[model samples]
Target: TRHDFGSIPQGQVATAEITVRNTGQGALKIEAVSTSCGCTSARVEPTTIPPGGEGRLLIRYDSGLHPDSGPVRRYIYIASNDPDEPEVEVIITADVQEPTS
Candidate 1:
């Protein structure tokens, strides 16, 4: 999955709310939520999701943690109990604009 914050001002925080669904026949348990950089953080609501149910993946990216004022990319990893795919990868991106004085 992928989420783009588009263009945002420097020294700002951007948020992305993603819907996570369990399409399998068994319960989906979210084991862990991690990010590639300290600039980003995320969490999953209700950790355990029933079959066909859905949850929310709330992510926050702070541009202040990242210095470069251009396109940037980060990652979010979600470990789950899915048989086919145990780990779900989310690519988060943003375009950071210079702050105006």
Candidate 2:
């Protein structure tokens, strides 16, 4: 659960979508979706997913709110009701750089 957005310039906003699939026998109920920091935010489509069904996790990271330049790291938390695993973690990274105009 890791994504690297190479070279995001200042003032730019980066976004990505992650797919969550339920391979188990029962339905996967997504309780909540959140980000580690204010600079990042996330949402999940269709909180309830039937077996073998998939859902999309929309993530947004605003470089302007990131506070600094260079390499940056953020996290996306997925709270769900799974027998073995209750919480899922997604990691996001970006090379925050100055815009070359």
Candidate 3:
């Protein structure tokens, strides 16, 4: 899944939510959630999702760590018990704008 935060001010923290659905017949258990860099963090609520149910993943990025104005991309890795897809990647993008003096 992918999420775009559009434009945000530098030094500000940005957040995005991603929904994970369990379409399979068995329950989905999220084993771990990790971010690509130290500037980003992610967590999954209700790590277990019943069949046909859904879960929420909260992702936070620290724009201040970038220290520049430009397009930024971050990734979140989700490890789950899904047999078909044990791992999934979520991408987040944003255009950081410089603060005015």
All candidates: TM-score? 0.98, 0.94, 0.96
Top-TM-score structure, candidate number: 1
**How well is each residue in 20-74 modelled by candidate 2, as lDDT tens digits?**
8999999999998888999999988899999999999988989998557999989
After superposition, the stretches of candidate 2 with alpha carbons farther than 4 Å from their true spots are: none
**Candidate 3 lDDT, 1-101, residue by residue in tens:** 89998999999999878888899999999999998999999999899999999989998999999778999988999999999999999999999999989
- Tens-digit lDDT track of model 1 for 1-101: 99999999999999989999999999999999999999999999989999999999999999998778999999999999888999999999999999999
State the C-alpha lDDT per candidate: 0.96, 0.90, 0.92
Report the candidate with higher TM-score, 1 versus 3: 1
Q: Which residue pairs collide, candidate 1?
A: none
